[model samples]
Target chain A: MSQELSDLDRRLINRLQDDLPLTQRPFASIAEELSLTEQEVVDKVRQLRDDGLLTRFGPFFDAEALGGAFCLCAMSVPEERFEDVLTKVNAHAEVAHNYQRDHALNMWFVMATETRGDIIRTAREIEHDTGLEVLMFPKKREYFVGFRVNA
Target chain B: MTLDPKDRAIIEATQAGLPLVLQPYTVVAETLGIAESELLERLENLKKNGVIRRIGAAPNHYRLGMTANGMTVWDVDDSLVDDLGDKIGALPFVTHCYRRPRALPMWPYNLFAMVHGASRDEVHAKRDRVAELLGDACRASDILFSTRILKKTGMRLRGQKG
Candidate 1:
């Protein structure tokens, strides 16, 4: 849990997320609107990231639109092999985010590929490389999982 | 980070709808008239550059029986946000968690978490667990359960005219 953001930081980030200006000097545009310098805005964003306050700053994609397939996969990697499995899993560009959970299905990750073949191929490859069973649960019906960072 | 014509084409085509076939990449390659390996390599490069976040299935959780989902916000102590966020994010029910700038004059809660379950009661149970974990450090919280899904899709980086 965290306290509220400062007025300046809140406005800057809200503008950034809601409608990132598409201009040559995007930061400058944002800064002008916020009554801050472009450098200040950039610096604040960098600081927020360094403080681990910002998960990430950028565009989110629609996986289905890309002709690729994706699924939420999990596995229980032996403690001794956690690092090895993590390294191999992270090596694949398809893995968006992976975490070590506190459960029987400890390791969980998201995998996406340009095509269905690539999706299956990459999953199998990871299984072969890590020697762990990857349980993939693809989205059957999507419900809204809003990413609005509430600012 | 700049994409060439071929790379843009591949992104546009695949983002449109990767052919649902045994050899989807091959279809993309054929349309692009390049080797499959080339297409693969380009995708790898795009991902490496962070131009594309991921290539995966965006599951319709509601269709799979986990219909209840809510955006739970917590007023966590600023000093403990990082550790608490990591712990909260590690929960299986919490598919997404992040620290966003707090909403002004309307919503003051900063910490946010999402939980999904088979039913509203299930989601509420999970929320109770989170509330217990959070304890007194939280000042206020709210759950905005979704009533409708607007739209969902993958990346469309190329088509938008800058």
Candidate 2:
């Protein structure tokens, strides 16, 4: 369901993905750079968000950096019980960003909690609830990758 | 880093998103009963500490025509995974690349890299580039395209203090 975007919108989307200036008049800089008024920049951002082209426009928090924990867990839910297991697993607030991937370990998701211990606790709870094994694939190391949309 | 009470308030206020306005910080600060300067200072500190990765906008890729999402997993030689992962991550097309412990017997993949494109063919073409880059270090690899989004509510902070 892709929709056509204006040339200006394309540039704005690409620029917004980068770090926004943290200032009282943050949009002022963006406006100056884009050769638009501050109000115009703000309005475009608002419109993009309102149109659902932008999911969020704010600080991206790192839970692990804030003393919380995040773990990538997967489970091979039986095809017949996928729906039931999904409901049970998604019921938890910690189960963030669950996806149904086409693989044996099909149901993959990331669990973010207030602490490291909470990761295991949630996994056990899901296993008990779903009657399936939750394989935790905690990141041993992360390679830096700058993610940006080429609007 | 431990978040102060005000920091927690700031997170709670803007976790979902910051207001879309000429001065979004002003509105958030006023709502939280803090001066704009103080709120900006705290936010600056949080960014420095890596608690806040960045202040930016996340585009809805699906709406932006990037409909294909592939999670490419590789069973690379343990000794070379890190070095290879660094290269893979640097490729502009690879969104996220990480080395995770392999759950042997069932799961033999240790490297996970996410690629997105306008179509599955485009994604696979990019995946082929990654495979070419890995050369002999990658023993076996597979890609898992997401069939559906079962859940996508990002991390939510508990109401009670930690």
Report, to 2 decimal places, the DockQ of model 1.
Answer: 0.03
Fnat for model 2?
Answer: 0.89
Sliding window of 10 residues with minimal summed lDDT for model 1 chain A: A141-150
- Can you tell me which runs of candidate 2 are displaced by over 4 Å? A1-3
Write model 1 residue lDDT over B29-136, tens digit each, in one string: 898899888887787676667555554223335433566787677777877766677777777678777665554445466676878887889889999988888887
TM-score of each: 0.48, 0.94
Among all candidates shown, the one with the greatest DockQ: 2
DockQ class, candidate 2: medium
- Which prediction has the highest TM-score against the true structure? 2
